[model samples]
Target chain A: MSAARHDGPGTGGDAPTPAPHTDDQPAVPGTGEWRRLSPRTLLVHCGWLGAPLGSLALTALATGGRITAGAWITLAAIAAAFAVVTAAGLVRWARTDFRVTAESLDVRSGLLTRRLRSVPLHRIRTVDLTASPLHRLLGVTVLRAGTAGSGEGSGELSLEALPVVEGERLRGELLARAAAEAVAEDPVLARINWRWLRYAPLTFWVVGGVFVAGGSAYRALHEMGIEPWKLGFVRRAFEEFGNGMLWLTLPAALLAVIALGSVGALVLYVENWWSYRLEWADAGTLRVHRGLLTTRSVTIERARLRGVVLREPLLLRAGGGATVRAVAGGLGNKEENRKRSGLLPPAPRREAVRVAGGTLRTPFPDPEVTGRQIDGDRHLVRHPRAALRRRRTRGLLFAVLPVSALLAGLGAAFTPVLLHAAWIYAVLATPAVLWLARDAYRNLGHQIVGEHLVVRAGTFSRDTLVLRREAVAAWTFTTSPFTRRAGLVTLTAAVAAGEEGYRVPDLAQGAAAGFAATAAPGILDEFLTRPVGHGDRTPST
Target chain B: MSEHAAPLLRPPRHRVDPRARAWWRVQALLTLSGPMLLTALVMAALSVLFFPGALPWLGPLLLVVLVLPAVAYLVVMPRMRYAVHAWELGERAVYAAGGWFWQKRRIAPLSRVQTVDTVRGPIQRRYGLATVTVTTASTAGDIKIAGLSDADAEALSRRIGEVAQDVPGDAA
Candidate 1:
């Protein structure tokens, strides 16, 4: 694939750029633009600010106890203690000093013992900035960065409230520079593969939809009086449903459930799609930004990519898709977002595809190769054409088929009341599964490029993984009792630090052996000679 | 020792990790431990209310529930640990060894390290212990080695800082 690199010199892709901040002024211990957010802004996102204190007052009134009394005093003491903490937090805003300068990123704040941390600009992997609803309201964003670590990490942070556009620009700049630096260091392994993002939203949508459905069901039942808040009512409803009257009642109930379920799914689906974008500024640099109600952006450098991972669940495998992440460059204000209930909500699939594709210039070449599989994003492809014997078991459409079968069996058995919504659901599920099957069949491709392997899978919502032979950070071999019995093993490769990712899956035994021999021929030979623990067990992959 | 053991002679697993659920849970606890300890203590207090003399009996139990678990966690598990067969790997990462109850091992490749912090708490200081926290971008969970001496922790922190300069992962 012909590619135009944005940061390559003389390629006219913003190749030469000055440092973001120049040392025009002396940024000493006290003087810097890196000031903490005001307490007013923090309070906007502080969930405990109001209700917690109100509850304490409520108990104070309900107990009919004087503040000076023993139990009341204990409660009051706790209240006072918490109040002091709140006051402390309110005061904390003043003392916090987050500095952004030409050289380093620094945060100096802690109640008892101050913490003064500084990360050089050059070492930065990615810097992520995020804004939650409250944060957006207050015009403040958090800056999170990735640094290398032993186990956890020694990350860099600058949590200063800034405007949305400014945050994005800053994030974009950092990401670009980080990537450029990464390429400068090792162009051979300077591969920026974002193919995993394509499949990320699908899982997000399905899981979010399920939760919305379940939560809506709970709410509707509670509201309907069929299942009241009172345990007695719930018990009665369950009892009634288990018996004769359920046939008639279930149809109505199922109708209401389906209605609520669709609404909830719709809300989650739309919510996840808002403001989602990720940019691989360059090789080692990446930027993740998204949100509708709240916008967030974070940038990471290549040096910070701890490992690369590829993940394929049974569902994704059926669809021949995978999700890859570059771990945690502190989630680009994810903590604060979570605090505001604005966690990694789903982004629109179109948005995901656009940004994911933009960052990834190529796709994997081969559709399927059965061998020692990498976990997370890398593909251990299993193609239908290679099968000497092919069998289409119920596994692909297990959920839909089983439900449909049960609907045919139990729906027929119990006068068809239970089949109402469940039947419709089964019907809907079958089509969805079939679509997924077709998508999976079409999305298969993989290739080994000059020792830098690029594996692409998924027909629609395709996921492409680029693995630089040089940048294979770590590899782990896992075998279980079941895997041993089946002559299979799972090999996990970790890449791009921060993202909790690994490419792992079960491989046919011969494939595993062959994979071990050929994948970095020298590495496997070393492993064979090395006294690596011989594990013999079949794993439940 | 067998020649096969050369590259395999890694440092012990980090005292502070399990990249899966164990890591997630411990991370959840560690991040919130200082504030949440009171809630656990309150629950423990309620449990002991069964007997008037139960207060004394419950102290150890509370320690077990509240403090010891955290300590044990600080003594076991890790996403990775680092040791060297030679110096080609550089000082970017270091080797940390811990865990006995259930043997765990790891290798913290310095390139993946996000940040290095020396953390000290009241209990930690009282016991003359400090922790070396290593953040990484590759793994969501941060790996840490706790209970080192203040000097050791500082030295480790410095070593990590220096090494990370030379060999950060792809981002560097």
Candidate 2:
């Protein structure tokens, strides 16, 4: 890619030189000079017309391939809508113009209001270039520049449908300020490992995605005035399945769903992680380049990197696989942050740890060194026994009781069958609930591992966060009435990057202050009456 | 073990203005009781229109479930908050602790302080009260000192703003 040439100096192609613009005669209503989005943006915007037109065609086909008077009217309305949309898209494209000045990147848009958003070049912490199949076909990509210190809504500057080369150049230009002098010979940290494909089925998407897709399909059919239950083929299929022995059909149906879901998961994995590469581009920017159909290249400034999170979902952990995410600033809002922060796909746990260590620039202690996994659970300080009791109480109170009560209540009001089901459910679920509670309690642990504070918590998706102590902006100690009585408190380490506040839940009351004091010194020192070091580190049994 | 039994964190040195108690009460009454009263009235009217026979028990149930808690909250919360809510600005950090049943103590270092703002709503204006919001780069670390006298709020914000101006970084 020509993007690499931007770092190599002298190999400039169509890259816009950041020569100071000294135009005194600024004529175009506002700003010094502005460049409009690609003309093909109008085409991208008009792509929505295809969906409605396709639906119309399907309706005509379903109705014996003859267009009725209403259908003709609908077609005319669609054409009018298409024309209006095209005009709107054209106006939007014309209005939306962006320019990279010496100090800042400015984007101007809107018809009447003429909104202008300018972000300082220094604060531009990440630049993302994304192109969908349609966008690729049109030879354009969307560029989003995320700025530092701006919270939530107003941090990100986006220019849709910039020509592919221009988008790459813009990305290079935006991040050029932070480009390091040392040209990295081997920038590649990790690449797509085909063996990791076995971990695909372990994701929540495997089973949950099937139901979600089914729901979406059902909703789509319903919206199109088709009742799936009332369909002849669907009903016939269900009848055939029902005709088989109940025991046999139930297992077969489950197997079929599992098979379908596995296929879906494999396909999704391939699409999302095809040719995935994590690299240090120019030694200053960490770049994640991935995706098959919708190619994404997210470049994050090394200075903005707070830490790395090693995520192990239950099934993934069971399968010995984990994922890694960047805890960096200027990844945009919550949704954008999640989408952009993924550093590694579901791969071997050891590989994830290695990637995490590489990303942090500090090698995490290998299992060989400590006879344990990377920043393993053994070294971490476990929460008090009261934490376990609290979890057990919560499980019984919230999960088990509510479900059983609802069933039992319905039985009292309506049927004896529900009453039987309630007891059966309680009997079946009690062990599972207890087991989950135990697992959650076991997962809860925190430790100060040199410069990084490692916190491992959560039951379903165990996230072991390795955060820099220096990145901690503030410290918050919270205690509920119950928690206070139990002699425990939850301490949250607030940072600017990733999730913002990571909680170290249910520490012994006295130990909480000591923990926070140790994790990030000076913040809590003035407030503590006694010296924090003198405080007891309550040993967890 | 003995140290573990002691307070986890000391209460901040300064308490909010005494009038804050009254302000919080009125604030609570307006926010909690007002909507609850309206909901109760609507429920009563619905019961009277649709199921008049159920009004005898439903009226009392609504009062117990909805109205009583709101009334209790309006009366008790202000006093509890007045006792709990305290703040102290150190040279390095802003310390604030508040909440009744679920207490929270927050510390935001001056170095990381991004923006300092003072807000006064219509009700707060009537009560001559203001809230000093010290926003850090982290969304979770925004320290808000509510129920402060207007003058105090202004002075606090100015102090924070001045200190933040001197201590420089991206605050990220």
Best by lDDT: 2
lDDT of 2 by residue, B39-151 (tens): 99899999999999999999999999998998898888888898788888888899898888788899989998988889998878888889898889998898989888888
lDDT of 2 by residue, A1-541 (tens): 1123123343355433222223322111212346778888889987878877887777777767877787788889998998899989888877887776767788899999999898988788888889988898898989888888647867888899787776766676666666455643566889999999999999856667788889999987766556889989999999988887989999888888888899999998999999899988866788898999999888888878989999999999899999999998888877888998999999999999999998988876322112122334237776788988999899888888999999999999999999999999999888888998898888887777778888888888888888898999999989888998999999898888878888888988877887788778878777775645454422211
lDDT of all predictions, in order shown?
0.47, 0.81
| Candidate 1: docking tier | incorrect
Displacement of the residue A440 alpha carbon in candidate 1, Å: 11
Give each model a TM-score: 0.51, 0.89
Q: What would you estimate as the lDDT of candidate 1?
A: 0.47
Consecutive 10-residue window with the lowest summed lDDT within model 2 chain A:
A21-30
* Complex DockQ per candidate: 0.08, 0.44
Q: Interface RMSD of every candidate?
A: 11.5, 9.4
Would you list the clashing residue pairs of candidate 2?
Answer: none
Off by over 4 Å in 1: A1-36, A50-82, A150-153, A156-227, A230-252, A279-285, A302-357, A364-466, A496-503, A508-517, A527-541, B1-172
| Fnat score for model 1 | 0.13
